[model samples]
Target: MIQRIQSVFLALGAITSFGLFGTDAAETEVPVAGSEVFADAQYDVYDSLILTGGVLAAGLLLLIAIFLFTNRKLQVVLCNVALMITLAYAVYGGVLWYTDSAAAQAQVDFGALLPVLTMLFAALAARYVRKDEKLVRSADRLR
Candidate 1:
């Protein structure tokens, strides 16, 4: 269970994705009643439904895949799906920054790539899952 390397990878993925909440892609000042308040780019996550959904989905998939260890192939597939979602999330943020102009007053932060770490972990977990599946198949053949 917890001893499995794949499980560890999946857990790390979940942690990193959720941890995005604590890290700011970028920081800016918000004015309220003539007072300036510091804020993080994370506020953008709530503004963009697609980005929010992708982040939540990617974390959820990694967590859910952990329990499906018995179904190694399916677990691998789910991790891959999570990987794709994370990739899209990162690219969407990148594109947003690239296309944005100074007139738009939007902050550009490569820190959005934080989710990419989760994607990397998911990919690693998928590789391990596939390895486990192959091992099982080989064992079955010998039996």
Candidate 2:
């Protein structure tokens, strides 16, 4: 379980997903009326229920996949699902940032890359799970 490389990758994916809560996704500057000043607003995963729940779900799925080491097929499936969800949430976050009226000078933050990292980890885990499955099959054939 924990000894497997796939499990480590899955754990990393989960950690990255959960890390979203600790960082800001975007920072926007709202211009003041007739002034050369702007107020800064930071957006994070907690700002939207969808973003919060999506990250939570993706993290949980990766964690669950890590424990499903005995069932490589299921673990791969879970990783794929988590990757898809992470991609979706990332795109949604980008869309939100693009559409924000006060985001005239929006700056993307580190949290915005968490989803991409999670997706990469999930994909790597799935690939390794498949490799392990193939290795088991080859070993069984040799017996």
Candidate 3:
């Protein structure tokens, strides 16, 4: 059961979540007061404790879910919870970018997409876990 497809998906999700620490979610150009130069500011998950903690928690949840393959129901629930956490952090990052008045222009980076990928992987894993549960229930009924 540990070798199932859902476990693979959960692992991928965890990897992507952990990958956030090394990538910049967004880049902004801030004009310096009394100067013609614009300063480049990059924001990543590590920039805020809330973001950093949320990402780390999400990654840990995915990793824990992988080992819970024997409990398909709980694994699915964990995947969904992790998905929610990832979404929250993604939105939080977007809000930070949007609320920064000093930012003249913002560019989305690969780090911004990692949370989306993690969510996708989590959803896929949950779907497969549900499928496995259904198959098991049906097989039991056949006995």
TM-score of each: 0.80, 0.89, 0.89
Cα lDDT of model 2 by residue, 56-79, tens digit: 999999999988889999999999
Best by the TM-score measure: 2
- Pairs of residues at least 3 apart in sequence or in different chains that clash in candidate 3: none
Per-residue lDDT for 1-143 in model 1, tens only?
55699999999998888776666564444422321112232334553577778888988999999999888888999999999998988787656544543213444455466787898899999999988888889999998
TM-score ranking, high to low: 2, 3, 1
The Cα error of candidate 3 at residue 25, in Å, is 0.8
Local accuracy by lDDT, each model: 0.74, 0.85, 0.85
CA RMSD for every model? 4.2, 3.7, 3.4
Estimate the lDDT of model 3.
0.85
| Residue 136 local lDDT, model 2 | 97
Candidate 1 Cα deviation (angstroms), residue 91: 0.8
Reference-based lDDT, residue 100, model 2: 66
In model 2, which runs have C-alpha deviations exceeding 4 angstroms? Answer: 29-40
